[model samples]
Target chain A: MTASSALPYQRLHVELDARRYPIHVGPGLLDDPDMLVPYLAGQQVMIVTSETVAPLYLERLKHALSGDGRDVREIVLPDGEHTKTLASVERIWDALLAAGFNRRCTLVALGGGVIGDMAGFAAACYQRGVAFVQVPTTLLSQVDSSVGGKTGVNHPRGKNMLGAFWQPRAVVIDTRTLTTLPARELSAGLAEVIKYGLIQDVDFIAWLEARMSALRALDADALTDAILRSCAIKAEIVAADETEQGQRALLNLGHTFGHAIESHQGYGNWLHGEAVGAGMLMAAALSQRLGWLEPDEVLRVEALIAHAGLPVTAPASMSGDDFLSIMRLDKKNIDARLRLVLLSRLGDACIHDATPSDMLDALLTDFPRR
Target chain B: MTASSALPYQRLHVELDARRYPIHVGPGLLDDPDMLVPYLAGQQVMIVTSETVAPLYLERLKHALSGDGRDVREIVLPDGEHTKTLASVERIWDALLAAGFNRRCTLVALGGGVIGDMAGFAAACYQRGVAFVQVPTTLLSQVDSSVGGKTGVNHPRGKNMLGAFWQPRAVVIDTRTLTTLPARELSAGLAEVIKYGLIQDVDFIAWLEARMSALRALDADALTDAILRSCAIKAEIVAADETEQGQRALLNLGHTFGHAIESHQGYGNWLHGEAVGAGMLMAAALSQRLGWLEPDEVLRVEALIAHAGLPVTAPASMSGDDFLSIMRLDKKNIDARLRLVLLSRLGDACIHDATPSDMLDALLTDFPRR
Candidate 1:
């Protein structure tokens, strides 16, 4: 057995009753096979990855997990948002069964958010809950989806419309994998990092405003600082309300509008974080119209989002009715009441339905160029 | 809405930390819309039922729920053990999306175990959980699957091999529904009624022994008494261990062996409880071989199961290897060790693995005749 001292990592614990687990953040986690052994309960392991990620780091992750005579098997799915379907989840179940998996088997989600969501869900229903570990490679996943354990596949009507709140046993965030991440993909991830600042922490927003250039340049220290802070904020929010009943809705600051955009534009046309980044500006403009945030603050939020290479404008062809129609089908809606999380000001957001429909209609038509 | 005080019903509250809800047991519950209204979160309600159940009671249930400007939608799936597939669940998702159902929409499972399981799982994953009420129609589901929060669809590998633990908002059990249940189906239901007595309460066992004929005859009083006691025992077991980590597993007394038989014979060929009934005899026989139960006691257990019109012998075609092969694939297996729930005495059963393999193999070969 390898000594524990060999693994250099920083641990952040997500405390949600019995579903509590750890998020280990650091470089060289792939070298520490011991990090995985303690969380796994059996010899059987299935590594679920995307075609985009498999050729890059699949073998190394497999090598890391093979330390304790583990029976490591894998299934590589087609890449992108299109792959997050029930058909793909069924294939995972098929692969696990073909390999003789049982309730004791552990599923290792070894890619970005799509792998984590689909694989985590596959584990949730496979034998009614098996252990699974997340190794999120993308910066967006490292900051948001990997730690909170909201695992689900996208539905045709809306994004993440069907799923379970299945938590993982552990999340291993190996920041070193970001080295090979495409520049645009990294910028898309910065959108979520920017979200953490716009929603909760102002000091962190100040930090990002100063160092976003370093983040774009793939500076290790800047990226680690961004990932660590974003995950910590999310961990606290998830711990408070794991099921999104009340306080947890704050995490969806731009998500309601973001999900609507993704569904309207089709899943792959715009990245999740890019939609979210643009959606945040819409929310900021609405918050300003509600007299909660000043117009200048809305401009600040917009400029920062644009600086991170995120789209700040909704598709010109999408009428107000298009936004209203998709938002009506949002999974977050309670009895068709379209509730959205909007900033009262920078660094604080609240789930509100008080925005007048005509005002929202006007904003959708023009979206405040100033 | 009709006054709740006018509705005749008995309430048993299921207490689990935050998931506390009630099971309303009565004769005329289907006549009272008020009983359903309190549990429902929104104006939108989706009733999920089997084809057999939809023809029998769907309109009646819908009429009862349609009061006070509610939007009631229905999804009628094919009725049978075979319909509990992930594909069927996706279709339910499709229906919900097509009808614009969201987080506040309540799912009403209006049939037997298959409907409760599949619908409950659909609720659990529909926007990461919506409120769901159980209106279990079959006697078996009324006494067992409906009471526990164990929800999932079956995989090809095994029965109920894929699922989640999602508690219903409320369970509406109407003993009147059992009147329409087929005669053979009634006998199959009695197997679970017999099981509760065998595993936990000897007094209940003695009670069933005296009144097995009346229960088989579908005597309303006998059936109500049986359902109440069985539900009470199950509620306590589930309350103590909602996830089946410890004491909750004792409730799965005959399920491990029963699942193996059902898998080998194909699901619909042997009714679930019929297989469980035969499985309980195997468990009792093994318990006797372990010197836990006397031979006379084993004979008595067999007699009671047989008296309930349940199959007491294994199929001659299934060799010992067949049971071993399927049992090895069981969801209850802990790291390759096949664990069985066996009787310690008439009133109690415990999870045991100490019985030698040769003894079990010998018994399966010749299920000893008296």
Candidate 2:
């Protein structure tokens, strides 16, 4: 499939004050190496990928990167969220040094969010920083993580506990990789897909309801359309608040609760998207309880998440108190104050300062048995 | 030793393209916390200092940091070149995440070069990249490491083999700290002092010879003046080539051969400054052998380094063949070609493409019976 043959897609630009980059979306786009040529002006290239995705796509990327007379090299890391650690980062640094990579080299991230984060970080530190390209493979990364340029590894105490907000030269998403994704992993990707609709686009939420079946079936047109729209919405929000200073906080609608669930459950016990699926349902319920959202709206969001094969309730082992304690350590918290992004309506949200009692009561109602 | 009572020192700035920063040198500078106020506008503050320096100065800094109602935290790592490693970085990330540090935070490196590099690397990774300040405690850091904004930990395979070129918001050099430095460490600092003279400051070299007695006696005024000048030359070179692009290569006059000597001798076997001291003499001999420098010029530089009580000869353990093999792994090499910075005259140097045979002969003659 060739990029030129695919349907035209919208281009969303993230305007960082000095370092600006564009996010391009469409079908069959990965095959077009010309789009990446402008950023690869240098001769040295280092591709960072993971074990699961490397064997499938690294060679193709190497060939595409070699188009501009650049010397191509690659470092393959272990797959899964567990690989996001200082130990893993050390491996990347060793590889770069062993290869004699300098500040002039370009680092290409060729896997999912973990690969993108770690690779982007390696580029950020290699000679202070080098150019980086994001080639997101997973659906979760394509819609969210790949767009913002937030890169780093996780600590045992929290998710994304350590990281930086360094932007990429360009982001390349190849929907072709989605064809090989397992059904369970594909369903996990829908969590972030649903997040975009719930935050700032009601019309898009309704659109997802109509096409959710097609997306789950991996229909090419439906999946591509969903991805392009998600990227466009994200690009707009990120451009306005690249560093998460203002409206960018809206993007974390369910992340505060989502991170708590992930942290309490022990990171890999549940995939990040799965936790977010359950977290969004909790946020909607809390919004209804707070009189900010209608009860019917809460039901609608929960139904969509359940229909998409995502968990709509907190993990059975986690008590209401456990969730509360974990959320306190969230990055959004200021001086131990718990700040949550709660829904005011399907397309509108606000960052609310929630009291400990209010949060405890809401949690008990959601996790009634506890 | 209040800043208000001291004579005003001239300021020199390092122009890093879009990100320019100033190098502040004077007595009692650290006591004036207002100097750090501009860079501390972020949400969280993590100060990376060493055990040796922390007990002596951390409280004074902590008091100053908390003045603006910002949340300031400190993490103290073991002191030494050996402490700069991946394991140490992991400890830093763990401490950062445990303290709830995020992208909006600024890491203040409060020790010598090792602390600055390790902390700077942590800041670079903690959330992709965050702002950091360099408060160099030792002369080596004040004159060399802190100014470049190059941050990273050492890999098991090599020194500074893993890191980034992330710049600092500001560099604070308090000459008062040098009063606490051990005589051995003070002499180690002189290694870099002689470096500026060997590279591109003949007049500075002549200046150093005239005041070697005062400097050896740790005269505060003379020491601060030398530090400011060394930084000025480095800032100019770094500004012209922030990433060692062109003339910045001159900074590595002794580094290539220095790194080989350090690696072969076992890192920590010789202080980095000590190896560079000897390495500078070897590079001078190699330059003379290549006819790029006169014999008299080599003797002058060698005499200055020896006068500072620094070793001017390589260790007996490092063989000529081993030195050549190790230097090839340096990032400065281009496609198996070894590049070395050679002095053309006092205060001027140029990078040359030296062949394996010429390099081997220089090493053999320079380190006979090795």
**Displacement of the residue B44 alpha carbon in candidate 2, Å:** 6.4
Question: How does the DockQ of candidate 1 come out?
Answer: 0.81
Best by lDDT: 1
Best by TM-score: 1
List TM-score (chain A only) for every prediction.
Answer: 0.96, 0.94
What global local distance difference test value does model 1 have? 0.86
Model 2 B-chain TM: 0.94
Task: Output the lDDT of residue A64, model 2.
Answer: 71
TM-score of chain A taken by itself, candidate 2: 0.94
Lowest-sum lDDT 10-residue window in model 1 chain B: B1-10
In candidate 2 the C-alpha lDDT for residue B67 amounts to 58
* Decoy 2 TM-score against native: 0.85
Candidate 1, A16: how far from true, in Å?
A: 1.1
How many pairs collide in each candidate, listed in order? 0, 14
What does candidate 2's lDDT look like per residue over A236-296, in tens digits?
8888887777888888888887887888777777788888888888888888777778878
lDDT per residue as tens, model 1, B1-370: 4654385678888888778999888786876876777899888999999989898899989988887789999999998989999889988999998998768889999999999999999998898889999999998899999998889888766678778999998999888898899877877888888888988999999999999988888787787788888899889989998888888888777777787788888899999988898989999988888889999998899899989888988776777788888887776777767789999999899998666888888877777422
- For candidate 2, give the lDDT of residue A286: 83
